[model samples]
Target: MKILIVEDEQEMLNNMRQSLEQELYIVEAASNFKSATEKIGVYDYDCILLDIGLPDGDGLELLKYLKKQGKDDGVIIVSAKDSLDDRLKGLDLGADDYLPKPFHMAELNARIKAVLRRRNFDGNTLVEIGNVLIDTESRIIKIADEKIILNRKEYSILMYLIANKTRLVTKTALAEHVWGDHIDQTDSFDFIYSQIKNLRKKMDKATITVEAVYGVGYKLEVE
Candidate 1:
């Protein structure tokens, strides 16, 4: 999953970023409101860890920006202020959850998972398409009730494609979600093609196909 950490506390930001990255999430950060706004304007994230306090602007305004853009990216307000009013306001402003300061990283991870499940999978950990089944929490994939092992990038690509099964997913979107900031350094989509090729071979026995749209992108076609 891709996440944005909007925090001003350098230490806290580093800690959260490191922890989330260790959990195999693509993480990006902005120490101030301006940078955060720039990122929010450009890309979509699976979840955003937003701090209500910023050096220059209120993080609540960022929530407003997201709503105005009609973006439904899941948000969790991570703030030092723990008042009931603040929590209610954040939720009212479209935040999926709230985490107070000085909380455990494990708890934060759990909250993120919960929000993702609620938002994307209708509160279910399993994602099923045709005969293929994915257990998001356990990171397992089963076809016809038989387990299949996939490399990390391959798994990420499959999950992303399944999430947008009804639409054409561009190479840029896939790279951004799977490789994160590292996509910027890539010179071509060759790496994406390689991963997709491997994933298609692994899923050959399944009732789904990843169809390439010539020079454009790919779409998941289910039988």
Candidate 2:
């Protein structure tokens, strides 16, 4: 999973990064509202840990902006404010959860997992499609009770497809989701074709079927 940590305190930011990195999440950091807004505009994150007391602006404004832009990214407020009003305001602004300062790292991890589950997996810990099973917590994919080895990008692609199962995902969408906004610099989508080919081969070996949509895109047609 990819996450953005927006906090001004250097010590707290480093602590959050270390804890989340140990859990195998790709993490990026922003110290202020401008940097956070820039990152949000360009990169797609599975979850964002936002600090309300930003240097330039209130994090609530950012949340509202994201909502206005129709971004469904999961957000959690990690701030020094622990009052009822603050919590209520953040929740009302579409924050999945609110965590005050001096929180346990384990608790933050749990909140992130829960938020992701609610956002992507229909509140389920495991996602099953035919013979393939995805354990979101472990970030592992299994077929017929045997684990399948997948590279980082491949796993991300498969997870995205599974999340939007039965829907045609265009090459442009896939590239943006997997490679973020940086894909605009690429001249061709040949790498995407290669990734899809390898994913299909792996799925075929495991008796899982993922369908191609010819010139349009791909779909997960399990069973």
Candidate 3:
């Protein structure tokens, strides 16, 4: 999963980033509203952990920006301000959940899972497409009764593809999701091709198929 942490407190922000990274999520951060808005404009995140109290501006404005752009990235307000009015306002602005400051990492992790589930998997832990099954919590892949083993990158690619199963996923988006933002330093998307080749081999053993769209991108083709 990919996440954006919008916080100004350096210590709290680092803690959240480290904890989420430990859970195998790709995390990025912004200390103030300007950087946060810039990130929101450029990249797509699976979930956003927003601190409503920014040194420069209110974090609720970020939610409003997301709405105006029609981006449905799941958002959780993580702020020291736990007032009823603030909570209500954040939710009304389309935040999926709220976490007051001074929280445990475990609880934060759980809330993120819940929000992602509600937004992406119809509020279910297991995501099912035809006969393929993915356990979001366990990170397990099952084709009916059979289980398939995949390496980290392979697993990430598969999860991303499944997340956008109905749409065409461009090479740029796929690279950014699975390999992080450093992809801009690389010269080619040849690495993606290799991963896709291997992923297709594994998928062929199962029921699901990933179809390449030639020069454009790839899409999930179910049988």
Top-lDDT candidate index: 1
Error of 3 at 23 (Å): 0.7
TM-score of 1: 0.57
The CA root-mean-square deviation of candidate 3, after full C-alpha superposition on the true structure, stands at 13.2
The TM-score, computed over Cα atoms with residue i paired to residue i, of candidate 3 is: 0.57
Task: Give one clash count per candidate, in the order shown.
Answer: 0, 0, 0
Misplaced by over 4 Å in model 3 are 123-223
Model 2 stretches with alpha carbons more than 4 Å out: 123-223
Q: Which ten residues in a row have the lowest lDDT in candidate 2?
A: 102-111
TM-score of each: 0.57, 0.56, 0.57
Give the alpha-carbon lDDT of every model: 0.86, 0.82, 0.84
Cα lDDT of model 3 by residue, 118-152, tens digit: 87777467878878888877888888768988899
Residue 7 of model 3, lDDT score: 94
Order of candidates by lDDT, top first? Answer: 1, 3, 2
Local error of candidate 2 at 218, Å? 44
Report the alpha-carbon TM-score of model 2 versus the true structure: 0.56
Considering only N, C-alpha and C atoms within 3 Å, which residue pairs clash in candidate 2? none
- Residues 55-95, candidate 1: write the lDDT tens digits: 89999999999999999999999999888998999999999
Model 3: residue 109 alpha-carbon error in angstroms: 0.4
